[model samples]
Target: MHVLITGAAGFLGQRLVHALAACRELDGQPLSRLTLVDQVEAPAPEIAGVECVARAVDIAAPGALDASLDEHPQVIFHLAAVVSSAAEADLDLGTTVNFEATRALLEGCRARKLSSTRLIMASSVAVYGGDLPDVVEDMTALTPQSSYGTQKAMCELLITDYSRRGLVDGRVLRLPTIVIRPGRPNAAASSFASSILREPLNGEDAVCPVPTDLELFVMSPRRVTEALIHGAEVAGEAFGPSRALMLPGITVSVAEMLEALRETGGEAALARVRHEPDPRIEAIVASWPARFINARARELGFQGDANLRDIVESYLGERD
Candidate 1:
């Protein structure tokens, strides 16, 4: 099965491309091609036996995205977006890139009507609102706070409607904040989550953007990638509602995280981190839900590792 992966140059995008390239799950049927699309033409990873196409695709620019959809990929991983903090700061750019661009891609998919294509959307936990109680909340009613959250929630509804109308098979996975991401801080509102761990591991000082008591949801990159693949390959009947699934992730406070780093990476790692909260950032982080139920996906056999330390170890590995 050939696949199209958007946001190919970004952190999780690059890893997903590499993982799928190494995947052998098409029942021994070799993958025919791998199409990597981003705003700019990014470097392609060498995958010896598969056809790979890397293209510069700008969804906001007229006709640019449509031109890149020619390959008729059987499966799609859509991870392209402007982060919440950036989206909030620039409303016009936010709607165009995060919301409208998604619709454009979906419309393109519908227009092409590739019977075999399954669109896997990478949504965020930001779709939900407020600090969740220590217990998980009901997944039915979605109340989003930030403009980014509202956009994602709306897209979720649109994706379901499109799927219901047979436009395409849409599987949306609402993601937890991906922690211990092994790179420089990104535009993501959750960038601080990764910074607290990744920076310390790199032996660099990282400023904690929120207080130690601040809590949020999290998932490892490996788990996030696995969910994307499962969403694409799993049967609709088994999945029932092909709409978004609120993912169950590791929920911990900023303090718990620091403690985790201390236990795992020792005093050196702990010493490298400093506390310095940005009020704007804190407000955004404060508005986001700390955990989600995701019982629907769990019932369908989707699950994550039990420890945050696993996420830490994965990022610390020799491989990127």
Candidate 2:
């Protein structure tokens, strides 16, 4: 299988690429070549069976899709996006990257005239917002409040339409706020979810942008990457009606997260987190729903972290 992955330099994208390289096969088919695309040059994966090529290209730029489409990839993972807070701050940039670029990529795939192609999109829980049920189900309507959520919701519809027309075999995975992320914090409102745990474990002080009572739906990077690969393996008939599937994730409050941190890294690590709420970030996160039933995901064989401790432990195991 010839595969293409956009936003290949980002945290999750980078992890997914490495996982694919390590596995060397997807759905029992040998991975022949992988084309990694991003604004910055993606790091090449050294795997024996697969030829990995990293290209620096902004898909939002004109004619970029045309150039990327030359690969004629049988499977495409659209993982690139301007993150939450960044998108909320700059609507134009968000639209360009999240919506326009996504539309352009799907159209480019349509132009390929292939018999069948699998297009997997990395969407988010941000797609659900404003007075949601205690546990959001697969049938829950997408009521996005932020500019970032609006862009993702719009693209989900576009991908669904294209798939219905037989243009591409599209599958959208509505991912949760990935916790215990490595590296420094980014502009995402949910960055604090990882920062509170990651920084504390690393012996650095971290700030909590929301109240201790604030709840969040979260998954680990390892589990989400596995879910991505599982999405590729599932047959189109499995999706049935809609192309979008909300992946299963665990829900925990900030206080619970701190407790988990205490267990993993001790009270010294727990003390490293200081609460100093940022209203702007608080509002953005507040608009998101923190609970989900995700029955569709469970039925589809996607899984999430068992608990907050497992999430923290998993990151520590991977990083340390």
Candidate 3:
């Protein structure tokens, strides 16, 4: 079967490509072809019996998606988005890339009669708002606080509706803040949490944006990828009203994160990080939900949410 993966050059995208290349269907069939699309182009990996096409194109460009999916992929993983800071910085680009691009892709799949196509989408926990009731039940509603969050919330609704109508088989994984992400930091507000610990481990002083007590939910890059792929290949009947899965993650305060880092990396590593909060970042983080009830995902036979210490150790191993 052929597969299509967007955000193919991104951190999660590249990692997913490597993982997918090694995966075999339950029936023991290997993936026939893969179409990797991204805004940035890279030298494609050579894999035996796999047609690897690396293309640089704005999927947001009108009519581009229709031309790309002529083969009608059996599976699609949509990971393209403007992310938190960019979405916050430019609302127009945010709505266009995050919300409109999603609709267009889903619509493209529909127009192509890809009824059996299993489309796995990457969403975020930001969709849930802050200041929830004292005890957040599994039944609490999603009330997004940021434009990025709002867009994610809106897309979840669209994904579920598409599944219900049988136009497509949809699985939306609402991912949490992925810690120990590899690569240089960019505009994402949460970059500090990982960067501070990561850079210091490399013997460089890293900046901490939020205070030590700031609480947030997090998972490692490994878990995010595993959960995402599981969502894509999972077997199930036509989904209920909600086709989304709130993936498992751990809730820890900034202090707890640093303590875990120190324990994993030693006092010298902790000493390399400097505590300093950027107001813009702190304010944005303050409004995000710290924890969630992802019982639905757990019941579906998916699991992650390993402790912070284990995540830190894995990240350090990758570094050395």
Candidate 1, poorest ten consecutive residues by summed lDDT: 131-140
> How many steric clashes between backbone atoms does each model show?
1, 0, 0
All candidates' lDDT scores? 0.79, 0.88, 0.80
Q: Candidate 1, residue 25: CA error in Å?
A: 4.7
lDDT of 3 by residue, 35-114 (tens): 88889773456678888888788977886677667889888889988887788789999998899988988898899888
TM-score of 2: 0.96
Steric clash pairs (candidate 3): none
lDDT of model 1, residue 55? 89
Off by over 4 Å in 3: 24-28, 134-138, 236-239
Native-structure RMSD, model 2: 1.4
Model 1 ranges with Cα > 4 A deviation: 24-29, 130-140, 318-320
Q: What is the TM-score of each candidate against the true structure?
A: 0.92, 0.96, 0.94
lDDT of 3: 0.80
lDDT of 2 by residue, 24-72 (tens): 8988999999999999999988888788888998888977867668778
| lDDT per residue as tens, model 1, 192-307 | 89998888877788888887888888888888888887888777556565577867687888888888899878999999998887887888787777766667888867777587
Higher-lDDT candidate among 1 and 2?
2
Evaluated at residue 307, the lDDT of candidate 2 is 92
